[model samples]
Target: MKVAPLPDDEAQRLAALRGYGVLDSEPEADFDELTRFASELCGTPIALVSLVDAGRQWFKSRVGLDAAETPRDVAFCAHAILQRGVFEVEDASADPRFADNPLVAAAPSIRFYAGAPLVNADGFPLGTLCVIDRVPRSLDALQRHGLEVLGRQVIAQLELRRKLADLARARDQALAGVRAKDVFLATMGHELRTPLGGILGLSELLLEGPAGGQDGVADDLRAIQRAGSHLLEVVEDILGLAQLELDQPRLRPRRFDLDELLADVEATVRPLLRGRAVALNVGRSPTPVEADPTRVRQIVYNLVANAIRFTERGSVDVTVAREGDTLAVRVRDTGVGIPREKLALLFRDFSQVHGDHEAELRGTGLGLAISRRYARLMGGDIVAESEPGRGSTFTLTLPLAPAT
Candidate 1:
């Protein structure tokens, strides 16, 4: 018996087959179903969707068969893939090439064989869809056509699966990139806080020391202290925002008097307003609301602090009220107004909007973002309304009661 020779484009065909990345893959229901259906249609006891590897012909889908693969030199499917159309042998024992083949001489003896090459779009035969019958017989015209159609279907399935796998890989990579960015920001917060603490500590110690009127030393130390203090706050804000971004922030919610909360915030902010031309207006909010008190306080504090930072000579007003089913806390500032176009960026992390001189206001730009998140975690949201010259108003709206 003579062994079947390789195709003229053997190297190209093998490369094209390997490019599919489907060899030794787990069996799929679609391919298996097609194989079983083909077996029934062709009146054969065995059917397979086979892939021709470099050293073996692997069965991707099989019916009425036990062996998963066979040596390429002895595989009838290997010879079938080399043909352009259906390759049929009425009787394998009468064919010189397969008569002495172990597959025909031993178990799963192939007497009547018919296969259609599974050709890819690139015109490479990667494998075949074949049927085998133990008795010597020939396939009818309709059966041969049906087998070839099923072979093309197998190629279509393989191509579709490859595309889906590529998309899944891309999605995983994008998610990984976002995780790495968040982790990097968190790590930098800790790294920045160390130097900021050292600078703040050293500057405070120097300021408290008795000076020899050392030229610019006193003024320099004061500037350092202010910068260090701002940097420390920014670092803390970064750390806090990172925590909120990466995980959920815990809320210790409780029932509290809205007016008393505003009073406490007024006392804390009044000391900062002492020497400034700005006025702190706390409208009467004699209403009680049920919510997380600490998170609510944090949200209000951040807004008030932000207003104070931007307003140089105008009043900063705070008002709280329960309107229907919602609680509204509005912070209005008469400092520098926000631009209409930059309003969309007000709550974005690491975003600062000071108009053309936006660069002058410095701190961790994470305050608004963190505040918004804190509000939402308690089932609320913050919105801003501003005109370029009329100043800005930030409103924090929350549900009056938690969802049951």
Candidate 2:
């Protein structure tokens, strides 16, 4: 419905109403409860805390009303909002302006109407708190005052909801920004690793062959190659994470035996378990899953690596199993568990849980982040559970393709 241009004061009020940012949001229980009580107190079949926008009147709360919004031109509350005080019509049938209105002509034919204008935080009249009835009735002075007080309450609720929404949006934006930075770091790491790997590979070949003469020189060269290779691995992990953040990374999916993959991940991380008095257990059912083999390896590697890194005196357990069309893998460690506050940041790039740079524990803080990215790339998810001073477990869940 086309509403006539609002007058100067009405326009200002309508702008103020929209500024609250409460229109078209989900129904809130706090305002709904207030309106429900008001409806009961006034003994009206229909009651609403309606907010007037440019072309419509929306109910923040409603009782005994099917419609959530109605055209402003045909709204009884629209006319009611023009005054600062109470607006009442004894009977719509007696008023020419509303005589032919659909609410008056149809079922639940509105006859009695009483509305109190709602004002914004700045005291600008914006909309109404109204009660409607089929039978013409008059409200006592106390009821009128109560409705006005309830209208003020509704306004307060709207303002609070608006503030909450604003805060939530800000939080989301901040997270997005952090995710972007992670992507950048990951990309640079990848680019640096590719070249570093080549340099390390060449250095190793030289140290092993006739190019190295003295034993001491050979040891020095081998150390350089090993250190470079480790750094290169770190760089690659960071780059992979960055690409994953932009959602631009592609995985090379292939059919693979789940049991074999689990065995390989176990073998790779076994060296970390030596002399720690910790046992490593691996369990995998003979399940085949279609996924990127390389990416899956990275996923398993990260989880197991993290388990070993955090657990100093206890065993790390790995499990892989399939249920129906889904594959599940879990890595459990008995070590110093992550704190509740730090658990959420585990998958965030460069978000290190350990604050002190102790010699025994060293990490780049990209393991979990990269693991999560690879899992998601292969249509899977990773979740964690941890309790401080006890242990932590990371679970990876993935979908399996059906047999041909």
Candidate 3:
């Protein structure tokens, strides 16, 4: 008996076969059905969907065969894979190469064999869909054609399985990257806040000392205070965003009055309007809500502060009222209205829409992003409407009930 030699492109063919990840896999119904069909069409007692591994021929699907695999040296399918078309041995017992082969002389007593090479899209023959008969016989033209068609189907199934696995791996990798980014942001935010708090506290104390009355000295200290305060705000926004992304935002909910919360937010942002010609007008009616007051306050403050920064000489209006089962808080600014195209960037992290006054109104661009996250976390959302020169309105809508 003659042993089948390896293909000319043995390494590449093996690599291509391994890529499918089908070797030694459990029998699948799709492949089993095809093997059964091949056996019936060829009038063979034994049929197989065989994959040739480095040292063995593993049967992915088999009919009338008890063993799962056979050594490659004695595998009839091994020789078949080297051929482009069907390889047929009319009488294996009479053929010199397989007459003395163990498969022909042993238990199954194979006397006839026909196999269609399973060739992939890249033209690598991975294995075969083959049939065996104990009695000497040959498959007609139609039977040979049917066997080749089934072989192509096997290759198609393998290709599909590989593609699905690739997509799953890609999705997992993208999710891992997002988690890593969140962790890094959370760590760095905490690290920077310690020093920033000290700077702001020291600057405040210096400004209250004898330097408070010094003209140039007081101005310098105030500048330091302002920069420190802005940096601290940015760090806080980063921490908030990272916490939300990590899905660990611990919200403490309680029953609170929406009108009173708005009042406090108004007072907090009124100081920011000291130099600008913006008038802060807040309209409210008594409204109760069940949610985290701290998060709600932060969202409202962000919206009001954002409006004041953009409006150079216009009115910023804050209004709150109940609409059915939800409460709506609208912050409308007469500042340079956002361009229609830039509206979508308002709530995306690190994304900013620049206008004529963007230089003076520059920010970390995380305020709106963080606000929207908090609103949604508590069963609410924020939306914007604007006309280019007429100003913009950001409305925060929240359900009156606590979030589940």
Best by the TM-score measure: 1
Which candidate has the highest lDDT of all? 3
Off by over 4 Å in 2: 1-5, 9-26, 91-102, 105-107, 207-404
The better-scoring model by TM-score among 1 and 3 is: 1
Candidate 2 vs candidate 3: the lDDT winner is 3
Instruction: Write candidate 3's Cα lDDT for 296-371 as tens digits.
Output: 9999888898888788898999988788888999999998888899999999998889854466576788989999
What are the per-residue Cα lDDT tens digits for candidate 1 across 1-404? Answer: 66568888989989988887889989999899899989999999999998988889999999989999998889898788767899999999988988999889988988999999999998999989999999999988999999999999999998998889888889899879868977787689768888888887787677667751564897788677667766766777877876776667678767666777787777766534633699889886645566788778777877887788778898999987777788899999987888888899988888877744656565667889888888888778899999877688999987775444
Q: State every prediction's TM-score relative to the real structure.
A: 0.80, 0.50, 0.79
Ordering by lDDT: 3, 1, 2
Give, for candidate 2, the lowest lDDT window spanning 10 residues.
Answer: 1-10
Give the alpha carbon lDDT tens digit for every residue of 1-404 in model 2. Answer: 22334646766776787777778878889988988888987899999988888788888889999999888888888888777877988888878878888778886699999998887768787788899999888899988988989988887887888788889999899889878777667577667867887887688678668867677887677667656755765776656665666566767787777787788988877755643777889888677787888788888887887787678887899887776678988899998888999889999887778758543454677878888877887888899999988899999887786686
Compute the lDDT of residue 105 as modeled in candidate 3: 90
Badly placed stretches (over 4 Å) of model 1 are 197-218, 229-275, 279-298, 338-359, 362-379, 385-391, 402-404
Ranking of predictions according to TM-score: 1, 3, 2
Backbone clashes in each candidate structure, one number apiece? 3, 3, 0
